[model samples]
Target: MEADYQPVSRTDAECLWASVRERASDPHAGIFGPSSISWKVNRESALFLGAGRAALLQLAHPWVAAALDQHSNLRNDPLARFHNTFRVVFTMIFGTLEQALAASRYLYQIHTRIQGAIPETVATYPKDSRYEANEANALLWVYATLVESALVAYECVLPPLSPGEREAYYSESKTLAALFGIPSHVLPATWLNFEAYSRGTIESAGLGVNDLSREMAHRVLQSKGTWVPVPGWYRALTTAWLPERLQEEFGLAFCRRERDAAAGARLWLPRIYGRLPATVRFTGPYLEAMSRVSGRGVGALTRTSNRFWMGQPRMMFAERGLGDAVELPQPLQ
Candidate 1:
């Protein structure tokens, strides 16, 4: 919260929206430096989504209305008005295609109570922040991405947008990129593609803050622009550095519970050994990259990855350099 926030500062909104546009690549900090997107505030932002349609009703921003409208019109078809925006800006990073579609339906479902938690959650952010602004397209796309992801993860479904429909989705997001003064080359060719899609939402690509998470959403809502503990909270899990509430809200604890399951050896192996070695801090770029993936891939011709979605797993032969390299004596100890 800004110290002098007046709830509706014409000047402040101007400055904030300007900063939001300016910090598109890295809006995790305040207008200047040092001030950041407090992870605590992010939980507040998620509260907004958790609040449901009532908050959506209270949310009067043109873009929010537009997204609502877009979602409504696309409910029957699911891809007509929202294909590319959903895919490139959102659908890829978080939830599955099925989850995205359910969120689509929920956002537009008629006469139903939109729920208390989501609306209450949404109320936490200062409405004037960039997340609700008309000019910041990245905020819009990423918000849609997150809302859809959270809904999908909770609902779990299949949102396969066909080839033709997919192209239309791509087209809409591209138009958004240009309208917001973002470079065309910056937009991702595919969702979660990171290469192209990351461009649509960056304040600075070189800084390495990509993907949507509660932390980034807080930045957008607060218009502060800092990248909080989003991309890799697991490292925080190892260090016990994250707030308990944020961790719980995002379900970090549930993942650890996997270790105790009877036959879930597949998930346990990666947690104990495939990941989290002793050679260095648990936070590594590789770990961060791996975090974005949901589900699994085959580890080789032989086995699986930490998650269970089943794509293709990557396999590497054991190496002999670097001081027993992360020598932790394996989980057998």
Candidate 2:
């Protein structure tokens, strides 16, 4: 653990309420309107758990696993990486279009430097076959994973969406994918297609979990160098949320006590979370965006950002791109 890393405290959150209260309902600031299912679902705090689930799904993809193994220092600096990723995600969902575009550009710049041949081939994909970050298939899988996990977490922690709302959420997610430079053709046209695509990928031999993916999943679940000490219940819930096929492939283990605890959390946590005050439940990106539209200084709101949230970092990491110093950890053999 980094001695210098400070966990976000309750005091930090106390300071944020004033800013949230003063936030404006800016109609033109964000891509997803307040009425959109994307905004309603993405605003919740439970997505922090969803992010872990999504990362595992992405890592399980052979191409994504190779890319991250070769390029990311996530194992060495999990908190920093997670913070950077979360900032990008929440910004796309809640930041103004300009901010979302900026975050997307930053991501694209990073991905541009991430091209390389797979270290090991699987099924049809041979080793030494090159993969680029902008590749449509890989990008689509990554985007789909996040969107799917967000919905999973949303339904778990909030009221279940109506059938029509579910479709709207999927449709709105395409806009999010577009912001990240994913081509329209790559995205599934509907919620049904997305579900089928995700299932095919998960069950496909071509995307089976590898050593690299398993190691990364272990690190996330174990909370190694994690910003906050992940609770046992949280770990249990996230593991339970993972696809059963993946659990077996990744060798995730849980005892009876843990399973029982997870079952309890699955039953009660969402209800409790849904009951939280709006100021407490909504994410910082949402609040900051509202501040911008409401004519309040976003700086004040940002001070309390990334602090006091279960999923947020105690200390924020600086956003980085291609030229930034990245200390890639030793690749999983």
Candidate 3:
């Protein structure tokens, strides 16, 4: 496998930002507009169904697991971590151009501070092998998991996208990858290529789950900070959906009862969930975008839902300051 672990350079990031600004015809619509498949797929509240799958997939990557274990407050405040994550991501996808740019800069700042060594020899990485949160390859894997898991969740409760739609969505997602500072040269050229990359990575040693990864996986699935405990059916489905190798590596139990529960959800969830009202079915960020376009402005209901998704009543961008001017590391020679 390619071993380039370089973080994004300041020059590259600036170029990407310029391209995004040039392409944004409607600044209020952010990167993807209302008609985008990204909006259509991500707008659904049902994407929450894939949250566990995405988390577990991320944990399976030793670099991500190590970075979180060493630098994140996930064990102490998973909900806050989760909320902060969604806040930045949703802002990039659904906020205005200024908000999206601010979110990207904020995220870039956070990533620059997160660098460490692997605690133990896991998979191909030796003990004390370095990891950086801003590394393009690791970022790509995390991005892939989110994109694939969202599709999995969306299809679980809604009509599956056609082949052309899936390709279009993947094409658009390259922009999201650019926002993360992943170099275009390193990204898969097409959706089919992306699927192959995901499958190949899953089978590679880089994704071996170590002790910390297993512990973190369980902690995330069992976390109950403020919110009610994760339901059994949800856990069952998460475990069932995971690649069999990773499931064994994580030691997640997928007994017949769990299997039955996951099966039942697959059988009935789509039929019932498809009938829900738009307000209940769609995400707050999408609703807020709609309100922005309609000139109605965000309302109390949207604000309430925003709190659920973003942990705040509205997306907050840092005011212009030194911190807002994210200081990237010098480019790798």
In lDDT terms, which candidate is top? 3
Alpha carbon deviation, residue 179, candidate 2 (Å): 1.4
lDDT of 2 by residue, 164-283 (tens): 998998887776776556656666778888889888877777567767779988888787866567788877787787788887788877668879988899889877886887666887
RMSD of 1: 20.5
Candidate 2: deviation at residue 9, Å?
44
- What Cα-based lDDT does every candidate model obtain? 0.27, 0.67, 0.81
Q: Give TM per candidate.
A: 0.22, 0.80, 0.93
lDDT of 3 by residue, 1-333 (tens): 227667787787888788888888988778888999889998999988998899899998888888887787776777767777777777778877877887777677678878888888888889888888777898899889989999999998887899999999999988888777778888999999999999999998878888888988888888744464888889998998899999899999998999999999998889889898888799888898889878887888888888788777666543545322332211110
The parts of candidate 1 lying over 4 Å away from their true place are: 1-155, 162-164, 172-195, 198-251, 256-333
In candidate 3, stretches whose alpha carbon ends up further than 4 angstroms from where it belongs are 224-226, 317-333
Q: Candidate 2 vs candidate 3: which has greater lDDT?
A: 3
Against the true structure, candidate 1 reaches a TM-score of 0.22
For residues 1-333, write the lDDT of model 1, one tens digit per residue. Answer: 212222222342334334334533322221111121111111121222222211221122223432332233322322222222322222112222222222222222221221111121122233233222222232334343443333322221113445554454444444333322233443456644532433332222211211223332233233242222222222322213222443343233435543234124323433544343322212121121233232233223212221111111211112335221221110000
Q: In model 3, what lDDT does residue 221 have?
A: 88
